[model samples]
Target: MDASELLEVLSPEGLRLLDSLPPWRASDDVVSSVAALRRQGHPPERVSAVLTQARLRARAEAKFGEFASRMLFTEAGLEQATRLNVAARHADRYRSAGLTSVADLGCGIGGDALAFAALDLDVLAVDRDEVTAAIASYNLSPWPSSRVRQGDAETADLTDVQGVFLDPARRTSGHSATKRIADPADWSPSLEVAFGYAERLPTGVKLGPGVDRDLLPRDAECQWISVDRDVVEAGVWFGPLARAGVGRSALVISASGAAELTAPADSEDVEVGDLGEWIYEPDGAVIRARLIGDLARSIDARTISRDIAWLSSDERVETPFAQGFRVLETLPLDERTLKRELRSRGIGRLEIKKRGVDVDPATFRKRLSLQGSGSATLVLTRVAGRHTALLCERA
Candidate 1:
């Protein structure tokens, strides 16, 4: 939102109007809602501002859950905000460490700050964007111990806080249509300055999961987290916040709860072996943390190929860290032969999984000209050292 829209939305009328609107749905008529409000003599600008928030609140529900109803957000802020469940985990780090205060540098709409304050810790939430800081102050207003201010995160006074959480801006400054900042140096507060905070204070830095591993500090513990199978963020912890004897970790969180695989360092890849009765696909977080070897050992599995993340074992082993599939048969990698084989089995519905292959699944599937009602998963990958296709079923 721009300055004028922000001002309009912060008014009493705006809050009341936003709360009064029915819960937004994809099927709702947005144009009609705006027209109805405008007809009621609400100014066009106020109507637009309130409706925008209403839509944002709907989208925010996936991240903030019910708390999103009362919170304010900008498009960019909502996009980058941490999921409430994940933020609670972050807050637990400080609370578990016996730290009673934290400085959330570059806090975006106070997503993490909300968690910290909810845990009854004092919070200093700082943001360089004035509008975002104002929105954050509003979101964090319910917590008496939480303070929000507009300032440079790098220059923010840290004299009173016991721990620090930094989420540097990895995108250009804007409420919308912002481009990603590729260089860590171009990020707001920069990685160097963000990491430097660990020299004195217990610190946790949230970064994109795809960040270069070489840039990580040797003294810190790096943990990659995946929620519902989607790898979300990589958190680097320092000092007491860093877990003992854990250097690299993969944390997977889903409706089933959380599971973690950790090692003192990246585990050596297990030796490649011939295809087994079961094929397992390790979670993205596991692959990103380079703990695939550890996961394989846990399940008594081995890599299908030297560099491939896919694993296989003759015994059926189940683990949250990976999805196991029972091998159905081996099929020729040639397109025409595979098409004939699939059609013979009446396999019309297919789930295509690929690794260490160049063919696009979507394009390849169309070329097969599938028919019939049966369904199966087609895994196109390297077996031993050669490209192969494995027809499989979820185990």
Candidate 2:
């Protein structure tokens, strides 16, 4: 939204309307609500702005939790902002490193800046977009340690700051339509420039988890982060922020809490062996960090195939880093043979899971016809470089 529209929304009457609204649910009738508001003599602009804010707040709940109600967001800015829980962890690094002040370059909608300021660190939150910067200023107004400015991050004077945190814009500009910029060189304040900041001060930069591994800096501590089962971001920490001796790490955050697997150096390859009684699917963060071998060793398991990531062992093993499944039986890879075997076993419901293969699970599921009451999981993968299927249940 434009500055004027945001101003109207931030006015006293607009805030009251936004505050009075109930938790929006799918059952709410939007057309009727707008009609009711119009009948009450509310201007269309204020109603439009209030409705937009309410909708954005509902969506933002997944990232900011309860704080979303009081925050302002642009469509693109909210999408690009880091989750508040993750931002708090990032803030801890600054506090732990003895860094008292930080330059939050490219700080969009003040997500990280809010966390940093909450920790009592001096934060200079910078964003080039005027509306976003203004919103960030509003969000951070409660903290005396926080400041927001509208300026190019690349040219921002940061001589007084002890460290820098840059979350580069990785997409095309706009609230309605944004194109993902695939090339790291195309990111605002390009990787080449951001990578150089570590030479002068401690630095941390966030990138897409699938960012080219070849582009990672050797001197930084690169970490892949996963929230629940979804891999969300990859970050590189330089200088003291880089955990000592650790070159790569996988950090998993779930409802239970957080767990990490770290490697002082690149993981070594483990020998492949035949499937035993159990199969282990390592977390995505572990796989992205290239630390699957470490996870395999910890579980006393061997790779199911040289080219595949699935690990196998003789007993049930459940660890924080991977999901364990008990092997019920092995199945034929052939479609007709598989159908016959499944039908004989009275399996009607199936959960198809595949790795290291091109077959689409949903498409294959549609082809199966059976009459049974049992539910089963089918693992489609390579074994000894040969295609195979294994039927199993959760361990």
Residue runs of model 1 more than 4 Å from their true location after superposition = none
User: Evaluated with lDDT, which candidate comes out highest?
Assistant: 1
Query: For residues 305-393, what per-residue lDDT tens digits would candidate 2 score against the true structure?
Result: 98688999998887999988888878667888888878898999999889988899988887778669998889998888888899888
lDDT of each: 0.94, 0.89
In model 1, the clashing pairs are none
How many clashing pairs in candidate 2?
A: 0
RMSD of each: 1.1, 1.5
TM-score of each: 0.98, 0.96
- Model 2 TM-score? 0.96
